[model samples]
Target: MRKFFLAVSLVLTSFSVFAVNSSHCPHSCPSGTPSSNFVVFRAPYTLSNNATTKFADWVAYRIAPDTIQGGRSRNFRADPLLFSSRTLEPDDYTGAHAQIGTDRGHQAPLASLGAFSDFQALNYLSNITPQASGLNQGPWNILESRVRGLVQGGGFNEVFVQTGPLYEFFFAELPGANERHTVPSGYWKVIYTNVNGNIQTAAFIMEQTTPRSSNFCFHQVTIDEVEARAGLNLFPNLSGASTVERRTGFLRNDLGC
Candidate 1:
């Protein structure tokens, strides 16, 4: 009887790990990701960690109205599933804020799933990037909040978000980081959700130098543009063949453009 129970527990554990929301990735996770990257599944999200960059190549999550939680925490730590050398420690950002005006920015965003018990998984270093304070705390934050607002305001049943760093150029190094890694030149985010029977997407890219007072809508771009810059084909399963869908300006009405 004990053996049977143990076997059942193992099966349940495996199922739980694989059961992280399928909608989080839309039809599938980004393809053409670097071969060095490995996928990590958490309760609230899934991420592909780049071994070379020591940061997530992309973090995909779903935000439902009820999942939006109040309050936040900062218990950043290394992902235990990843090799110690392949992930950053909390110390990596010790003096980063004061020295470089950067923050341990979260790709999955605590604000998206703060109400859940596994919300801390968003704090894992593998899911973080050294985003500039102006970008991380300002426009970047505004974008995150707005994404949550879409669901909380009852506009959508769920919102899917995929975000990652863009190494267009190397940025400053962390004061406490011991591993060799490239800081991002910028960051990109692609948000999508189902409306009626159609799918809508809004993508944006922001640099570390983006003005704190600037509007996030001003930085919006096509999914193709983000794919070209980041080298990952996002939302590949989405129907159609338009490689580059550029908008003259932010035109997604639901996204408040």
Candidate 2:
């Protein structure tokens, strides 16, 4: 049950977007799978592997009321789910420490997963990209925290989140040997939510750079745009899920700006 979409009926609006059962889903492209270039891992949350990129192609999860808070210190480690040695290990990011100005930017943010076990799952190298200090701590961090606040105050029936990085190219002449890995030029996150009967989806993109202030790197995008950029279907099963995509952000309420 934790691995795939819920088997029970998820009546979003009229017809079910997700299949009645994960076994017989109508979607041509589900979150993750074995046949594709990415391998799927469902440790309660969904993480799809992209061994060629040495990171996750996407990480998806459904957030509920209980996801707002979880008390635990970060325990960074390698992903045990990945089978191929070609995938990155924790050691690959040793040079990406905060002291070096690059961060092991989490694609599936730990704050959103709050629970200790779920949070720990995010520490996998597959869930991270080499992000600059500014973007990691600035707009991106603020956006993650604000989402928690929104879910806490409001009553959202279901929230599906998919996050991953966007690769442009690789540069061997970067700062360190670790930098030789495929560094993403930007990152994207898409959030699907059902509130009271109406559904809304928010998408965002940010460059991999350090920001001096919050919201500086926030580029509001649409689900279609992200689909084109990420080269993957976020919710292929959704069919014509909804056109209520936003360009600005996933932030339901403003944190500061």
Whole-model alpha-carbon lDDT for candidate 1? 0.78
- Candidate 2 residues lying further than 4 Å off, grouped into runs, are 1-36, 98-100, 116-118, 169-180, 214-218, 245-257
Q: Report lDDT (Cα) of residue 255, candidate 2.
A: 29
TM-score of 2: 0.75
Task: Tell me the TM-score of each prediction against the true structure.
Answer: 0.87, 0.75
Measured over all alpha carbons after superposition, the RMSD of each candidate to the real structure, in angstroms, is: 5.1, 7.0
- What tens-digit string does per-residue lDDT give for candidate 2 at 1-257? 42232211122212323322222122333442223344444443655565556776767766667664555556777666554353666666665554456777777677776663556766766676777777888888877666555567655644667778777654222244452356677778776665565556677877675363847334667877887777766666564654544244444443233
Q: For all candidates, what are the clash counts?
A: 0, 3
Which stretches in model 1 have alpha-carbon errors above 4 Å?
Answer: 1-21, 241-251
The local distance difference test score of each candidate is 0.78, 0.59
